[model samples]
Target: MTPKRVVIAGAGQGGFQVAASLRQDGFDGEVLLVGDEPGLPYQRPPLSKEYIKTGNADRLLFRNADFFEKNAIRYLDGRRLAAIHRADATVELDDGQVHGFDHLVLALGARNRRLPIAGMELEGVMQLRTLADAERIRTAIAPGLSLVVIGGGFIGLEIAATAAAAGAKVTVLEATDRLMSRVVSPAISAHFLAMHRASGVDIRLGTMARGIRDNGRGRAAAVEIEGGAVDADLVLVSAGIVPNVEIAEAAGLYVQDGIRVNDLMETSAAEISAIGDCASFPFGHDGTLIRLESVQNAIDQAKCVVQRLLGRPEPYDKVPWFWSDQAAFKLQIAGLTAGADHQVARPSDDGAKLTVHCFRHGALIGVETVNAPGDHMMARKLLALATPPTLETVEAAGYDLKAVFAAVSA
Candidate 1:
């Protein structure tokens, strides 16, 4: 029997993982990983944080070059997938090459949303998304340099923290009332706002960027807000990203917020599926269509897709988890809390450790922890368990929520 051919587009985190997981699941087929980036697959979470400050490119690599050869995964770097010929079961590359596949996975991920204000075309303004973006930001980070970050989202705040720690005057401007308002809870946002303020980051909330001013030599001189202007040598636009689903949509696939996929990650079209930031799947608890851009989501969903390809049908119902490292704090979260009604806080003895439990109609829906890994781990287990603890039980267990969970489990 001839081995099956699996062609994956967008060789980022999820794209690369899909190929690896397919082989791991005993699918001895031709795996072709295509990415527009010109190198091996690498982790993107550090691109805005550590990679921007340390310039440690080696540490960002997901796997070595030899691993691809050993696994028989053909990686085509610096090549963009212009179109998907779904009818013919082939992918059209920019170089006019058509690769046929028995199965196709669209892990096209997302692209950073660009600022529309004036002077954005200036040289000093940048966006952090790919390795090249990190390289540019890394070289621009110098002591005494004024760095103005637009957007108070995770990427912007993480970059702001790194820039501040590197001795740069970092100022974060967010149009929203709080940072990370879309994904995290109000308590978590307040905690991070306090943390950033304490770390000397000038955070300006409810502020919108009017335009950018150029010093006439094609470099950004300052960022203009509604009331006044702040002088900045470098401007980093860390706005959120939009899913890359144009090609998939052009190929007559369902596109709603992202490429719509079923529990098995299969799209509307046969022999074609989507995953990662570009794919919106059914979230278990609320049964709502959700798209997650975290590394954990990408990897776990890739595993599910691989299992399905190997004829092992299983629902992709893994608990969602995410983390963000800034300065000395590691903020970890387990499970989704999209429509939670109430939140409970549990602070540690030292006041540095904090955990916030999100409840939807008295049931534990999500958990947010800062510098508290044990509690975060327990929260994941509790979310996956048959009977989650009630709010009353959580309150009776004292501030040490992990101990309460442990005692109950024992």
Candidate 2:
């Protein structure tokens, strides 16, 4: 008997992983990977930092041409999935080809949110989300150039650090009260704000970009803040990302915050599912729908869907984790803390490392650490266990989170 065909839209991090995982699980199906971007599948995280600083495009490619062929995966590059023909169980591409699928996966991922302001069409204005975007920014970075970044989120700060280190005068304009306000604690935000400032990057908090001005050369020259103008040779808008769900919505699929998925990453429609940044799966703790854009979420969710397709009835319940490399600090987060009610910090003896414990109504929910990988690893392990150590226990153990867990288990 011939195996069924599995068609995936959006050849991004999750989409590629889904294809690879399906084959790894011994699914002898015709796997089709469709993407709008031209070229092989690549990682997006390095686009802001390492790729921008060193311009290494090769490292971003997830797999070479041989790997795709060896796995019998059909990679449809440079073609966008225009619509999903649910009744016929086929995906209509922009080039007028309809590919039938026994199972359909939507891993469309997310795109950088464009700011609505004047001079956004200027030549030097860029948004770093794809390898193409990173390449353009890499060519633009030069010594003595002034760069103004809008938004103080992870991408903005990382790009600012890279541009500043490359000899660019960088200024970050954030409308928020503090940097990383939505994710990190006030203490962490203050620490990062000082880090950027000390690195010669002018970080303007509570400053909104009203508009952009051109330098009469069709290039962005200055960013108009709330009251003043900051001169910039280039402007990078690193605000945030919005999930790409137009195809799913057009196909009559349910899309709330993102394409709603069940524990198995299955969508409301039969034979169809969604994952990665384009998917809003169930949060185990609150039973609320949550969409995560991290690589870990994408990889884990893809594996879960593949397992389900391979006759394994496993619900996706993996803990969410993420990491950001900024300057000399490595920030790691384990689990989701959206509804965290209390937070406690355990500073290291040298004051160079810190671990924050987040609790929700007296139950440990998440942990954030700066320059503390061991603590972050322990937090992930402990959070998975039936009972985790208390915040007081973590502190009383001399900030040895792992030792605290070991002692409790012993």
Q: Which parts of model 1 have CA positions greater than 4 angstroms off? A: 1-3, 403-410
Angstrom error at residue 329, model 1: 0.9
Provide the TM-score for each candidate, comma-separated.
0.96, 0.96
Candidate 2 residue-wise lDDT, 302-348, digit = tens: 99988888888698888888888888888898987656788877778
The lDDT values for all models are: 0.89, 0.88
- Please give the lDDT score at residue 408 for candidate 1: 67
Cα deviation at 202, candidate 1, in Å, is 0.8
Tens digits of per-residue lDDT for model 1, 24-93:
7778879999999998889999897778778999999989999899999999999999999877888999
- List candidate 2 stretches off by more than 4 Å: 1-3, 392-399
Worst 10-residue stretch by lDDT in candidate 2?
386-395
- For each of the candidates, give the backbone clash count: 0, 0
